[model samples]
Target: MRNLLIFCYFLLFFIGLSCKETKKEDINITTDDIEVSDNLQAVTKKSKSILFFGDSLTAGLGLDIEDAFPAIIQRKIDSLGLSYQVINAGLSGETTAGGKNRIDWVLKQDVDIFVLELGANDGLRGVPLSETRNNLQAIIDFVRQKNPEVKIILTGMQIPPNLGVEYTTEFKKIFPELAAKNKLELIPFLLENVAGIPDLNQADGIHPTKEGHKILAKNTWEVLKDVI
Candidate 1:
């Protein structure tokens, strides 16, 4: 009986040690995750903001988010060792009016640079030229109001004349006019070489493929390098 008791005690002690080791391992794994928070805070503190606010093109549409122009831009920025954080605020199918509506909320964060890429959907939907212009203007006003020092970049867009030639011509002029009036930088057209290019565009021909996004990043980086 004494021998039996001894064996039982030894077994219980070994089991207890095993349980404690397992608990300690779990704790170590949790600690490693917690350690990542320190790095996150450092990154946040060091990074400045470059906000891309626009529609589906900015959102990447059918492509993977990483294949999106904004992410490509992010990679470019990182490659250059720039400290700017590229925030992709693109909403699929958003119009200038919708952008205006959300401008205030979007501006809650500090924006060092703002890229406005809206109005394409409005043209496609045949929204009035005046309304689109007004909405875009309002978004610009709100952005400046939020941060007067923020440098704004306006991206021009052209639509098929589903509405009419007159409407199409007027829509094309809106971006340049706004850029001139606001003294903001302009991209001329967001989808320059990629647009209407069968190989560059996806099957739908609206969004760009991975190769196309590379061109987009190049287009943006051209103007972007000068600014930053």
Candidate 2:
């Protein structure tokens, strides 16, 4: 009887030791899995995001949310299986001054690229070219100050012929000047191919149609693909 009891005790000790070792191995595997998951999440978060700042032109004015230029660009990126998020900060009827006021809010996001598309409404409203320029320059300066590494893509706007040749010329110069000064990628005119096309524009003759939005997306992608 004494021998049997001793044998039982030894058996229990070995079994307990094996169980403890098994548990430790499981814990280590679980910890490794958690660490891998965390690292993958960090990589996903570091992917690029873009912010589109402009007026109705960028807002898709009369169009649906999915039809907006920002959304269009996002779709294009997704189709290519690229990781990107494009936030549209466009406000209808917003001028350069409005953009200046709201720029801080726009920069609050984790933005990798900023597509500055303001001053179009300023030109439309006949706002002074200097004020428009100052407002736009201030916005660029503020953004650069906050994030020097953030890429900027400046999109130009053209005034209607009714705005007159002299005013139009000065208004058009604002984008190039700012782009050159800041060393930004410039899209000479956002509506280059679609602006005058009757079928591409909405009845208002200001905003672009769905097809027009696609063209604008292509224009943005031309510059964006290289950077991101």
lDDT of each: 0.88, 0.88
Off by over 4 Å in 2: 1-46
Identify the runs in model 1 with alpha carbons over 4 angstroms from their true place: 1-42
As a whole number from 0 to 100, the lDDT of residue 77 in candidate 1 is 82
Measured over all alpha carbons after superposition, the RMSD of each candidate to the real structure, in angstroms, is 5.8, 7.4
Tens digit per residue, CA lDDT, model 1, 1-228:
999999999999999999999998887456667779855864685568899998888898888898999999988887778888888999999999899888888888778999999999999999989999999999988899888999999999998777889999999999999999999998998888888999998898788888998888788877877888
Q: Pick the candidate with the highest TM-score.
A: 1
lDDT of 2 at 157: 82
lDDT of 1 at 84: 81
